[model samples]
Target: MLIKYLGHAAFLIRNVEGIRIITDPYSPTQGIHYKPIDENADIVTVSHEHWDHNAVDLVGGNPVVIRKEGERSVRGITITGIPTFHDKEGGKERGENTVFVFDIDGLRLCHLGDLGHKLNKEQISLIGRVDICLIPVGGYFTIDVKEAKEVIESLNPKVVIPMHFKTSSLDFPIAGVEDFLKGTERVKRLGSSEYEIEKDKSPLEREVIVLKPAKSS
Candidate 1:
């Protein structure tokens, strides 16, 4: 499968069967400043109703949008949306968030959409095994670096990809990816916006893969 970072919390994942899925399509009006998302996908997952993460209209291909918590199979991909919160206060501060788990091409990929708090035993049990994790490390609006580390330990995904952090184009008061990378080991800087993982072929271990945003500044 190929995973391409589309800036912010958005990602374009394509499985071996050529089925494409886009996660958390952001809006330009949110002051994110990432190049407008113009990619096409077979499925689009929205974490919440927030303007920055639920702009399903920006995506093409007349994709199927999944926003609520449930289990569904779309185009041979099994997607499970676990209800979460955008704030630690049980959605009182921000709103509801959904952590999407995609079973594609023999791999289980989890996208923590603007996750606010640490996962409890119940949430962890529901998520099950995770091969790849797309997490948000920025603080103010989501979990901070410290909490992110704790969450990573719980999920224990073989591959970790940090997103929704501070970037040159983002005006949010969030920390950069560097803050999350500090003191981390086995970090691979691909220097590109895309990374490919082969089933059983790629080294499936605890490694942090950093990729540049695909969208131009």
Candidate 2:
């Protein structure tokens, strides 16, 4: 499977069967000076209704969109959405959030969409074991560095990828990825936007892979 970071919380996941899944397609109106996502995908998973994450119309093709919490299977990929919150007050502050877990091509990939509070034992148990974890480490609207660390430690996935942090294009006053990388050693800076992962050759232990964000166009 190939995972490409499409800036911010959005990602394009493709498999050998040509199945494409885009997560949290962002809007250019968010003040990010980049092109909008116009590619076609087989599926789009939206975590919340926020403008930055729920611009499903921007995606081309009549893709099947999974925005609510439930079990869905499409093109040999199994997805489970667990209910979460965008803030600590049980969705009173921000809104409802969905933590999506995907099982595709023998790999379990989890994406925490704008997750705010730490997951409890029940939520973690529902998520099950994770192989690739996509987490939001920026604190202003999501979990901070310390809280993100705690969450990563709890999930203990073989691969960790941080998202939703500040970048040159982003206008939010949130912590950058540097703050989360501090004191961390098991990290690989690919310097590129895309990564190909083989299920059979995946790591046995946890490691962080940092990739450059792909252009919005």
Candidate 3:
């Protein structure tokens, strides 16, 4: 399987069979209307209803979308939607968020889309073990660097990819990439949008892997 981080929370995962699954396809200036690129894929997994995370229609394909509050299987992926609040205490502000835990190729992956606050013990128990975590470190609407550190500790994922931050297009005044990389022992930039996360290997300690945005069409 190949994991490609497409800026923000967007991701493109391709299996050995050449089937592709896209997660949170968000592009500031290259969708069907806003962003011109076609996000068409075999399956599209959305973590929440946020504009940035639920732009599934922009992908331009009638892909099966998984959301709401249930466990649904799509294409060969076992998707479990764990209900979560968008904020610290029972979503007193921005509403609710859906955390997706997908099991594919014998690997379990979790994508915390626009997660606003730190999770508690109950929330942690729901997620279980995660092989990879696509996390947010943008702060204003999500977890910051410090909070992310705690999330990492609780989840203990084999691979962690930071997302939701300032880009050349995203106008929101969120923290930049440096804030996530600051003091991180190992932050390596993967040249392209794709990579492979293996569990047998050792993590770079407290390192974070920064992936470049996919080439806009």
Candidate 4:
């Protein structure tokens, strides 16, 4: 499976069969200056109703959009939406968020969509085993660097991809990815936005992989 970062919290995940899935398609009008998401996908997952994360109309191809929490299969890909929050105060401050888990090409990929708080025992149990984790490390609106480290320890994914942080295009009051990578070991700066995961291959010793935004201005 191939995972391409489309800036912010959005990602385009494609399996070997060419089934494409997009997570948290952001809106350029919401002060996020990243290039518009004009790509096509078979499935689109919206984590919340926020303008920056739920611009379903921007995506082409008449894709099937998943917005709620549950288990479903589309085009032979199994996805489970685990209910979460956009704030630590149980959605009172911001709103509810859905963490989407995709089972594609014999790998379990988890996308934490604007996750706000640390994971409890039940949420971790529901998420099950994660191979690749797409997490948000920016502080103000989501979990900060400290909390992100704790969450990573909880999920224990083989590969960690940090997203939704400060970038040149984003104007949100969030910390840059550098804040999360400070003093971190086994960090691989790919310099590109795309990464391919082989099912039979062993996990990388370099756990944290940073990818440049694919849709920057």
| Candidate 1 per-residue lDDT over residues 90-193, each given as its tens digit | 99999999999999889999999999999999999999999999999989999999999999999999999999999998999999999999999999999999
Deviation in angstroms for 42 in model 1? 0.7
lDDT of 4 by residue, 1-217 (tens): 9999999999999999999999999999867999999899999999999989999999999999999999999999999999999999999999899999999999999999999999999999999999999999989999999999999999999999999999999989999999999989889899899999898883756389999999999
Instruction: Choose 1 or 3, whichever is better by lDDT.
Output: 1
Model 2 error, position 187 (Å) = 0.7
How many angstroms is residue 134 displaced in model 4 relative to the true structure, after the best TM-score fit? Answer: 0.2
Question: If scored against the real structure, what TM-score would every candidate get?
Answer: 0.98, 0.97, 0.88, 0.98
lDDT of 2 by residue, 1-217 (tens): 9999998899999998989999999988857755678689999999999988998999987899999998989888999999999998999999999999999889999999999999999999999999999999889899999999999989989999999988887888898999999998789999998989999989887889997788643
Model 2 misplaced stretches (Cα beyond 4 Å): none
Which pairs, if any, clash in model 2? none
lDDT (tens digit, per residue) of candidate 3 on 81-105: 7888777767788888888887877
lDDT of 1: 0.94
Tell me the RMSD of model 4 versus the true structure: 0.9
Model 1: runs farther than 4 Å from truth? Answer: none
- Spell out the clash pairs found in candidate 3: 29-35, 30-35, 30-36, 31-35, 31-36
Worst 10 residues of 1 by lDDT: 198-207
For model 2, state the Cα shift of residue 123 in Å.
0.4
